[model samples]
Target: MASQGDRARDALLDAAEELFARNGIDAVSNRRIVEHAGAANHSAVAYHFGGRDGLLRALVERHHEEMSRRRRELMEQLGESPNIHELVTARLRPLIELLDSLPKPSWRAQFMSQISAVPSAVAVAKEVIGDANLPDDLRFINGAVDGIPESVLRGRAYLLGSMVVGVCADQEAKMNEDANKGNWEQVGRFLIDAAAGMIGAPVTDPDGAVRYPNVPLI
Candidate 1:
């Protein structure tokens, strides 16, 4: 059985996620979150999470545990050799699956999108990332590509992550009891295809030159 304190902490996180998702993170106050959680003590969040940043970190960590498990399973299936598509799918499938499982009016995707856009939220994520064991979804994809600088690859990955978060937020916004499940499936497939191209695309030379096989030189 969960301790009363643990349950109170979880309630705060759930409340915070919904509030942060519906309203921008900046717009939601700590008092609002505490109230929404139904905790008799406004200090429950402070007692459990220390503060807003701590609360945010806890929420992100909760989702990371869910997503990381799925990521590792996909990585195992991909084995020693996997295509870019497979790798991209592994990176994204967890979030998509999570969205599918959440109840209607769920706010997780939008909350994540907010996190991606906020420096504080991103900093919280960075802290967690530093401590956590992230699935190296880019390893095989990195091996396949040639001539692209490591910095460039990192930039592309950042862009790809932003796109995925933003798109899913949009998907969740549009979702309701009347919404078609096919739309969500199509969005997931589209994101996978686009991400594969993005992560695998050849980099151009610094001196205004193109080296990718198909593109004509400028």
Candidate 2:
């Protein structure tokens, strides 16, 4: 049997997720969260999650546990050497795996879209992942992109992350609106390909010359 506190905490988390997804995190208030949860005390968010930021961190941490586990398993399967495509897939597959398992009309994709968009929220997310050891595929991917110009590499990483989150959020919205509209595996493969291209693209010089002509862009 769940304790009253556990139930309250769960309720708070649920309400927070729904509200955050519907209205960006900054727009939602602690009072709104408590009210939505049907929690008696106004301080329930504080007691259960410490505060708004804590609530967001807890939400991401909860999801990341399973997501990270699957990612680690993927890394293990690929050993220490994975191609750019496999490495990109390793980074991306966990999110789809999680998306499939979540409740219908899940707000997690929107939540992630918002979280990764805001610097403060991104900091909280990084804090959640800080405890987990880095996966091998991540290390490989890092090394693989080592030759890229530092500026270009950083820019592409930002673009890649934003693109994936935005696309997945849109896809989730589509699925919620019409379940049969989106194909999960195909979408996942497409995202993997997109991310791989972004990371492995050839850097072009101002004179229209490709920095690494030998490297395939796609």
Candidate 3:
């Protein structure tokens, strides 16, 4: 049986997620979270999660455990070798699946989208869920865009993160308006195709000059 403390903690997390997703993280107060959770104690957030940062870490870690499991399963099925598309699919599908598993009007995507914009919150997220640094395919991607300027390569990496987070957040917001409005599987496939295309696209210099040095991309 779950203790009252555990139940209170979970309530606080749920309230915080919804509040933060709907009204940016910084805008939501700890007191508001406690009240929203229906906890008698005003310090419920502190007592349950230690503080705001701890609360954020707990939220990220909760989803991260499932995500890690799904990612491991996907990677195992890929065997020893996988192409860029397969690798991108493996990396992305777990998140899409996670979002799919969530109930309608979910705030997970928006929660993460907001977190990504805050450096401190993003650090906690990265600490819990790891970053976008895909080491295994570094060499492969480097070779794929060997001739492209490092600036362009770096820009694409940033854009890909924003694209995934932004699109998911937007879709979730839309779904809240009409439960049957969106198809996440289709969105996931489109994202996979778009990401793979961006990664594999030929580098065409608009000007006849290269701006960035030929640095090996990470």
lDDT agreement with native, every candidate: 0.74, 0.73, 0.76
Report the C-alpha lDDT of model 2 over 1-218, residue by residue, as the tens digit.
Answer: 99988988888888988888879888899999899989789998889888878888888877777777887788788856678888888789998778777888887787777775456676787666641122233446667765665445545555666677788888888888898977778889899998898888877752432232111011
Identify the leading candidate in terms of lDDT: 3
- Model 2: lDDT equals 0.73
Overall local distance difference test of candidate 3: 0.76
Clashes of 2: 0
Estimate, for each residue in 1-218, the C-alpha lDDT of model 1 and write its tens digit. Answer: 99987888888988999999999898998999999999888787788988889988897887777787898898888867677888888878887888888878788888887875577877787767541112255545667667766656656666676678788888888785357645666788999999889877767753433222211000
Give the worst 10-residue stretch by lDDT in candidate 3. 209-218
In candidate 3, what are the lDDT values of residues 142-189, reduced to their tens digit? 554546665565556556667888899999999889878768999899
Cα deviation at 30, candidate 1, in Å, is 1.0
